[model samples]
Target: MGRHVFLRIVDVVSNFDPYFQQRFDAVRRKGLSHLQKCTAAMCMLAYGISADDVDDYVRIGESTAVEALKKFVSNINTLFEGEYLRKPNENDVQRLLQMGEARDFPGMMGSIDCMHWQWKNCPKAWKGMFMSGHKGVATIILEAVASSDLWI
Candidate 1:
């Protein structure tokens, strides 16, 4: 992610939960920054790194990193789900329709596409069902509908 995007996410998370906001520890003389905690969690989840491995760069204990990840996910679900992951409403549909009409595809507001995503966490037994031997990778296919501004 770009610096701006990362900071924006951090900003949202910090606002949602004070735990993700950087803090000073006057008593212990040290405190972990939210960036450290969040970076550690992102590395673990995005790269499949072990919790202990996150300590090398972030200097966060495994338990603390895990806790941060848990809290981060919980707070994201609480704060952003309403806006990013919502079913399209009537007003949204009307806008989509207008865009489609301009393109000469009246009454067609959205299109569907099927995509295959690598399933990094696919179970062993389920691999046979989802894996494509030709691609030599385990993948799950999903069909999604997208309009100009939203994915549903």
Candidate 2:
């Protein structure tokens, strides 16, 4: 992600949840900044890394990183769901259809894509079914549709 976009997300999420705000420890020293917490959360989500792995670079504790990830996802959903995570309306569908027609892909309103998401806690029985041949890890396939604007 670009710096500005990442910062914008941090700004929005921090404003939505005080948990992202910097605080003071018992010694009156400043605690982790919003960027650190958010970066830790983002690293885990984007890179499919474990919370323990986040500490190596983001300098966050495993438990705290888990908490930050939970809060970050929850707040982002609560704050932006209505605007960015909703199903498209009639107007949106029409616009996308027209755009697709212009590009010679009639009736295609958006593009669909899939990615393998690591399933860290897969059950033993299910691991065989979920395992990815190339990655050699248990995973779940996540599918998404996005318009030209990259809204998923």
Candidate 3:
């Protein structure tokens, strides 16, 4: 993400939730900054890493990282639900259908696709369940339907 966009998100989230604000520990030493908390949350989201994994990079413990991520997501949803995360309305559906038809995809509202990503940290117990038979590697499948305008 661009720096401006990231900073904008950080600002909005920090304003919405005091949890993102910097605080001092019992020893009066400053705890994590807003940047650190937001970075920890963003790293887990962008990399799909476990909360524990962000500890090494973001210097946040697993539980704290998880808390930050949850609060971040909740704050974003609450703050931007109407503008950025709304369900498609009738007009949106019609527009999507029209766009699809214009591209010769009659009756299609959007294009659907799926990709498999190797699960680098797949648990040993579930490895076999997610393993691809041909490639013999554990993977997770991600699927999305996006309009021609790239709205997913």
Candidate 4:
């Protein structure tokens, strides 16, 4: 991510949970910047990387990276659960059915789909998780359900 976008994410995260704020620890150098912590956490989650793997790139310790991951998940659950992660209700289902009809997919309330991606740079031990075939390349597949009105 670009510096601006990363900073924007750190800003949002810090606003949601002040634990991401930059601060000095008791006996060490000043703590990692919120940007570093957030970036490390994002990398670990996005790539399913081990905490130790983020140390060199993000200049964070393994333990701190893990801590950041835990806190980041907690804060996201706390801050955004209500609006973005909510389940669709009856009205949303009705609207989706209408949209499907207009789109010539009658009776379909929502669409379900999946995407497969190669994980070429994945770490050796982690490749098994994404390995789905004998191609010797790791891969991941993402599945989602959504409609014109909501992701549900």
Candidate achieving the largest lDDT? 2
Over 1-152, each residue of candidate 3 has an lDDT whose tens digit, in order, gives: 99999999999999888999999989999999999999999998888899988989989899999999999999999999987788888998999989989999888999899988887777899998998764788988888889978898
What lDDT does model 3 reach? 0.90
Q: Any runs in candidate 2 off by more than 4 Å, and if so which?
A: 114-137, 146-152
Can you write out model 4's per-residue Cα lDDT over 1-152, one digit (the tens) per residue?
68897677678889878789888778866878888889889998788788999998999999999999999988878767776667767887788888999999999988798877777678899987878884667888877788876666
- Which pairs, if any, clash in model 1? none
Give the backbone clash total of model 1. Answer: 0
**Candidate numbers, best TM-score first, in rank order:** 2, 1, 3, 4
CA deviation > 4 Å runs, candidate 3: 25-29, 48-56, 76-87, 132-134
Clash pairs for candidate 2: none
Best prediction by TM-score: 2
lDDT of 1 at 51: 80
Model 1 lDDT tens row, 50-151? 788889978999899899889877877787778775777898889889988988999998888998878787789998998876478898788788876665
lDDT by residue (tens digit), candidate 2, 89-125: 8998899999889989999988999999888867799
Flag the better candidate by TM-score, 1 or 3: 1
**Alpha carbon lDDT of each predicted model:** 0.81, 0.91, 0.90, 0.83
Query: Between prediction 1 and prediction 3, which has the larger lDDT?
Result: 3
